[model samples]
Target chain A: MPEVLKIKNLHQTFEQGTVNENRVLRGIDLNLEAGDFVTIIGSNGAGKSTLLNSIAGTLPIQEGQIILKGTDITKLPVTKRAKNISRVFQDPKMGTAVRLTVEENLALAMKRGQHRRFRPGVKSQDRKFFKKQLAQLNLNLENRLETEIGLLSGGQRQAITLLMATLQRPDLILLDEHTAALDPQTSITVMQLTEKLISEQHLTAFMVTHNMEDAIRYGNRLIMLHQGRVEIDLAGEDKQNLTVPKLMELFQKHVGSGLEDDTILLA
Target chain B: MAIGVYLTFRILDLADMTAEGSFPLGGAVATMCIIKGINPILATIAAFIGGLIAGLVTGILNTKLRIPSLLAGIITMTGLYSITSRVMQNAANVSLLGKKTVFTIAQNWGLSRNNAVIAMGLIIALLVIMLLVVFFKTEIGLAMRATGDNPQMSAANGIKTQGMKILGYMISNGCIALSGGLLAQNNGFADLNSGVGTLVIGLASIIIAEVLIRNLSIGGRLLTLVVGAIIYRLILALVFQMNVEPSDAKLASALVLVVCLTLPNFHLPRNLKGGKQNARSTKD
Candidate 1:
């Protein structure tokens, strides 16, 4: 399988040459194959979000080369790169415009990265397509096309946001702890839906999570970051039988230090 | 004109002071064009283009130079004051005394001058409202709406938010200038002080209509804005007829705006109405 994403010599340092300089991602390198669903686990400040932001073009690349498929996108602005890259933010409210109706939000998502013309928003023909897409979520959002996204619950918003991110089948989808704001029950439901959607579309995805069980349970591959570097990258059979305790033992064995409970509590 | 204010203030979420300068700028430009023997319709369009240029400068200052939006508008508004005078050959006012304005042309068709002005204003306002209604429903229009509603989300979804904001200001001030052009022709004079309370008038119209029509389609809201402006002008006329001082008109307009703005935040007595939670529980 062709490499869908390549991160070469990635280095993100905050407030460089200042007294408060913090080295976030220190010369990190990564490669993702097509249809890879990789779940990443890390401590609070382990540079997970920073890494995602760099790839998503939300942050300027201080020193790195981010090659997506065959094109170098390290210098692309967030809006320009959004054609091939879609993202679900940690905040449910960050995913969709609150004042817009459900169908309008979907319509905006439909033209992601495409040249937007002066055509009517949410056309009659597109409405039927949107309804069909909403129905697949089984959230009964098809009936609420005209409802403002703000009036929906957090779980509903996240589900709709997930749908928006995948509406056009982006080359890569980044979920930045997308369900972290929801209750445990809703989180599980959203996660299940996410798994269903990713598999259904054969999408390449990078999911950052604080939950160890989720890190192990969903994706085919798993990665654990410690101090701005990948400490463990497990896949296939090695990941299938993994448990939280076994993962911690492996972390301790590799990093030559006792795993801190504070980091695990974040899980 | 209030619809233009609504686009900037409500839709784009920018409190642009450029309207004050651009309003008079429109009249000044139109007066200049009339002096050059240009057609009135073409002169009005010239004024609109002038306003669009003024808005473009303000947008660049805010977006490219990183100035605060309010300050950017203020700077542009202040600069346009001198520019408007320059456009009128260094005079504080310009007279279009015997020129053929849209109203004058209409009056030649066997209608009273007063009726002609009213008819022209209504027709022009309705045309603008119809165009805006259609424009706001377009794909690019949805992107602009999203930019105002949540700029971060807009950028995330590949919408050029800063560009959208600039376009919003351009359209906004263009409408204000067009209104100024009409006012100049209607009154047969474009005075520097003609735009003194124009922003207040626009706000008054928008707030009054929003209060009256709480939930409406985008098209309906645009229509209500025009109706609200007409009603507001009639009220001002009535106040003048009651022998009130003309100098107090500005104060009266300001007070009307204040009351309308604060009305929505008024809380009813707890027992006066069935609360939402209580009603839901009762239904259950």
Candidate 2:
């Protein structure tokens, strides 16, 4: 399969030219093949989310070229980039409108590109399609189409958000610790749902997570980012058989002794 | 007439200011057309268009200029003040006392002037309410509401939030201008300063309506806003009837607004504490 996303010599600096100037990503290069799932692991402020934002066109890159499906998208604005990419945020509420009903939210997502038409919300067929999609989550949300999304638990909302993000099956999907806000049990369910959807849709996905176990367990490839550089990139059987101890050994070797915090090693 | 209807207007009134200019602009344009020998009904339609244009200006300033929404409204209103005055041939106020006002036309059709004014107001209000109710049911409308609720999510979902904001401001101000226009025609004149302090009255009405109509339904919420506006006007009339000094009217209105805004803060619900704690933790 062809490369779905390519990032070359990417650099992002916050507060550039000021006293508080901080360079987040420096001379980064990455390529994602179509239908490839890549899990990125890093400590706080490791430029994980920043990298995702750069690709999604939320944050402007100081220097780099981002090509999505062979088209240069580095200079594209966030709204234009949204046509080819979909994102699910850490907070469940961030991905969906709380005040609107599930059906209404789905309708907005469905009308993502064709916004000029002034038609009444969700047709009966669209409602049925949404219902079928919601049923796939197995969260009993199928019957609750008219229920306000605010009434849903965080886990349920995240699942719905996952479903919505994949509704159109864009060229790339970005998941920024989407299940981080839920409880452990709910997180497990959401993670399962995430994996299922990514595989079923054969989507090219990039997910950033703090959990080392999840990084090792899910996705076909695992990458560890440190100081704005990719320290480890393991794939295929190597990534499949990767253990927590091996990841810690690799992290210590590449990132030096500063990341020896117990929480990180245990995570 | 009923408490429910009264509360509906209150919710609507909460979102005021743009309405001040809009309402009077509606009245001014309608009256201007009537003066030019246009039919009373057609004049009302012209008033609606005028209000829409004012709203469009405010929307453009907010979205294209990136000015804050409230500030955008204020700028449009101030500009409209001058434009409305110029449109009326530099007269700060124009009276339809002997002209073919909507009221006069209604009277010619055997309706009393007071009855005609009330009927006209009701008709215009109903049309606005109906259009908005239907609009809110559409995909664009949902996206527009979502823009207000969570702009980031709307943008992330590929919705053009800037365009939606502009469209929202336009619709809101358009309704306001329509109200203003109708008010001018009903009262037989348009005054440049009539929109002054009108935002406060609208806010008071919105707050009052929300308090009265606690139901969270969308239709209930919009209806309450309109009712709140009417109740707000009735209360003002009652206050005038109580022999309150005309000079202190503005002061009283300001006082009412201050109380309404501050009252909700002192009585935060217990459940909200958890959300606040979550917010604090997130900051940490």
Among the numbered candidates, top lDDT falls to 1
Could you give candidate 1's per-residue lDDT for residues A199-228 as a string of tens digits?
A: 999999999999999999999999988888
| CAPRI-style quality class for the chain A–B interface of candidate 2 | medium
Q: Kindly provide the TM-score of model 2 when superposed on the true structure, using C-alpha atoms.
A: 0.91
Q: Give the Cα lDDT of each candidate.
A: 0.87, 0.76
State which candidate has the highest TM-score.
Answer: 1
User: How far off is model 1, as Cα RMSD?
Assistant: 4.3
lDDT of 1 by residue, B92-163 (tens): 888898888878878988889889988888888988888888888899999998888778778889999889
Specify the highest-DockQ model's number: 2
Per-model TM-score, in order, reads 0.93, 0.91
Q: What TM-score would chain B receive for each of the candidates shown?
A: 0.91, 0.82
Report the C-alpha displacement of residue B202, candidate 1, in angstroms: 2.0
**lDDT tens digits, residues A179-222, model 2?**
77899999999999999999999999999997888888999999
Q: RMSD of each candidate?
A: 4.3, 3.8
Error of 2 at B2 (Å): 18
